[model samples]
Target chain A: MDKTQNNKAWFLVLPVLVIVAFSAVIPLMTVVNYSVNDTFGENEFFWNGLGWFEDMIASDRMHSALGRQVLFSAIILAIEVPLGIFIALHMPKKGFWASFCLVLMALPLLIPFNVVGTIWQIFGRVDIGLLGHGLASIGVDYNYTNDALDAWITIIVMDVWHWTSLVALLCYAGLQSIPQAYYQAARIDQASRWSVFRFIELPKMSGVLLIAVLLRFMDSFMIYTEPFVVTGGGPGNSTTFLSIDLVKMAVGQFDLGPAAAFSIMYFLVILLVSWVFYTVMTTLDNAETK
Target chain B: MMRARSSAIVMTVYLLFLLIPIYWLINMSLKTNTEITSTFTLIPATLTFANYVTILTDPSWYMGYVNSLIYVVLNTLISITVALPAAYAFSRYSFMGDKHLFFWLLTNRMSPPAVFALPFFQLYSSVGLFDTHIAVALAHCLFNVPLAVWILEGFMRGVPKEIDETAYIDGYGFGRFFVRIFMPLIASGIGVAAFFCFMFSWVELLLSRTLTSVYAKSIASTMTRTVSASGMDWGVLAAAGVLTIIPGALVIYFVRNYIAKGFALGRV
Candidate 1:
């Protein structure tokens, strides 16, 4: 596959490099500049060294935000991975029903994040929202705007509703790719349904599931718009994940130095995890190829 | 046997749970505001197009649709143009620093949109392109182009090299070979890539909302500003949400198979 002898190919990639440099690299450098320096009105700057990073690392606010973010992502991965697999298992193998279910599943993914937030926002209203009203009528006390647990549940449920389909669809695709001979062989051996799933389907699905995990992890880590629209980080800073807190610092409070440092740290964390994902997936790819 | 039955029951309940909100949206869209707010009617007490009529007739609401379309088209076109060549290079060559460059593109995808919100505003403003459709389009291209390149590269690699050689043997030049042979082979791939580009740009808010104010505002942005002294306007908001689905749904219907394939690959 190597074609390094053909230097002319470099011309094709030159434009993309330029565009990315301007958009990503330059702005990143600006962030780095902001991170180390103090800025005042009229474009004045003062060198602050690693002060912002130190402050952020020591701050209780940052610790709580990071904790909330990690917990949120962990809970998301837990609920979605299992739920999606279950849906994929029960989905009709090949029929009108399969297509029907797939298209329906994709419906949630297409809705805009703000709108998804709005739907759950309205749907969780104690007065009008179906969930809130329905629950209250049954004598359960539930209010997202007031209770932290209720807020967390609403956000988690909102995410599950929106994203589980992606995991399901990916798993379904993996299932579809399984060779019929493998299934026939399992059947010939008089394998139980559980054994068939555990031995054959589970291993086969692992490849796509790895991808699902990576995507979900990256997405859940960066999630801001839905939670923002739904809760506005609410009833105090209870639901303010890292991204929400960063925005509040940068825009709301205009603390550019701390926000910039936090963003760099945020980017680094994502980069580290994404690299781990890439390395793992590629290693698996190599194993499969071998 | 009992476990299977219970599993089936669990999955069915899950499906209904997923579908009810969508049904509620459509249900609310059809109902009058009074009906939506007052009655907890499972079905609309009376079907009405008042919400749709209001949104369509109002310049502000209708203009949001137009602005969104303009930026989406611009984003798609720019993404495809830049991405095609980059994808071609990535797929066909092992040029200097190719692996590094490929990974670098992915880093753009991983960076949180919020991180870039302030810097993008400053970057665009310095260039005198603030609050324009082109600004949003260009900002989106930052992520879309990389995604397009990665997805398209995967598809392009699947095409046989023999065709390129055959085209060359027949005296076809690079341009002809790429247009006549390479393009048809990867048409479905490009279609899927284009759809992803459109979908991401369409749904994006943090960047889009930050970049534009008046001329290039999107439907999603309009939904945000809908909250006023008149109250939250749930009926109109639901209608807008339902209407926004039209473009994505239409795209999905046409390329349902490709969309499914694209999703399986995690292209978007």
Candidate 2:
């Protein structure tokens, strides 16, 4: 199917670039501009020359938020990836039941982040919320507002409930795409179920799982809405991820110069890590295809 | 056989863990504030629809739903319209600076929404678009359009080149073929993309909250003011949260199959 004529499909792409540039690129440039300069309001601006960047990098507030962000992303990947794989493994391969399970697994994901936070906040209430009240009745002193450990548990549990389904769904797709002949061959070799999964399924799931991990990492690193709603970055900033802190700087304090610099640094961290994930995953994809 | 039984147990436990919070939310919505605050009940001691009734009868609360719905729909429409052409271009053509452009679009998706909350408020207020649904809708498009383009482009590539050739040989122009044949075949993918655009825009709080103090406030934004003279209205908050789940739940239930595939498309 050699093409002798140019279709001039460039027409299709121009609208996208234009819209995205207006919506994204312009705002980003504004943020970049703010990061290096000081403004006193009413369109007055002065060059500050990396002063905000230096302040942002050295600030303990920034350091703590970065630490929390990294830890949270690591925890999310650790829990969701394996748990999703386990659930995917157990899911009925083909039947009415399989479809039913798939739909059931997907329900949590459909709920919005803020709503998820609200639900947990209510559900974890000691007086009215079920989990908190139940825990108290059962002799567990669980108060998310007062206890740092409880706060961590609540957010971590909330995230796992919301996102593990995504990983499961992705891995399920990878599993579904596997040819049945491989299973039959494994059976012929008398491979154990554990061996079959370890040797065959794991490798087959690498591509989609890479995607799952990357998406989860990126999202977890930038988590704001749910945790913000749940704790309001409370219990002494223990649960304040990088995003929430950035919001506090930009919106709460109206420190545009510092916040903008923080945001750029934040964006760069996500970009750098995502780029690494993409490179490693694509290389593996290439090797697998070859 | 033993392994199968254990796996079933594990899956059941996992499902229960995932659902219990949502269940509690629904249960609390059915209870009165008195019952909610005074005692811990596994099931509501007495069920009431007062919370739902409050949200519905009150024009202000229900207005949040209307506002969120309008902007989300608008955002979805605008994103899909822009992304369809863009995604097709990326998928079909090796244009100048395609890789760089694609990455640039992705950077939009990756940037934190919180970072833009203040600027968006200032920018929109200066332009007199503040407190309008259009403002929130347009702000959402910043990220939503990039996401829609990436996902749609992935699904579009899976469509065979043979279809394009057939349309071309039949003397069907690119526009006609795209509308008549290509769109229908990728209906599921488009549905998936539209659903995502709707979901993101629907749940988004920061910009929606900052940009609209009154008119375009989303239900998520409304949840912020759930505290009243009577203290935080757990019953009302729970009720609002449950209501917020309905739109996305209904949409996902209908497109359950596509949701899985669409996620794979977006991420990859």
Task: State the displacement of the C-alpha of residue B83, model 1, in Å, after optimal TM-score superposition.
Answer: 1.4
lDDT string, candidate 2, A179-242, tens digits: 9999999999999989999999998888899888888988888899889888989899999999
Q: Model 2: clashing residue pairs?
A: none
Task: Summarize candidate 1's per-residue lDDT along B143-217 as a digit string, tens digits.
Answer: 888889977987886777777778899999888888887888899988988988898898888888888888878
Candidate 1, CAPRI quality class derived from DockQ: medium
- Give the per-residue Cα lDDT of candidate 1 at B174: 88
Instruction: Specify the poorest-scoring 10-residue window by lDDT in model 1 chain A.
Output: A1-10
| Per-model DockQ against the true two-chain complex | 0.58, 0.59
Write down the DockQ of candidate 1.
0.58
**Residue-wise lDDT of candidate 1 within A122-237, one digit each (tens)?**
78888878889999999999999999889999999999999999898888888888899999999999999999999999999998898889879988999999999889998688
**For residue B168, what is the lDDT in candidate 2?**
96
Model 1, residue A142: displacement in angstroms?
0.7
Alpha-carbon runs more than 4 Å astray in model 2 = A1-7, A281-290, B228-230, B266-268
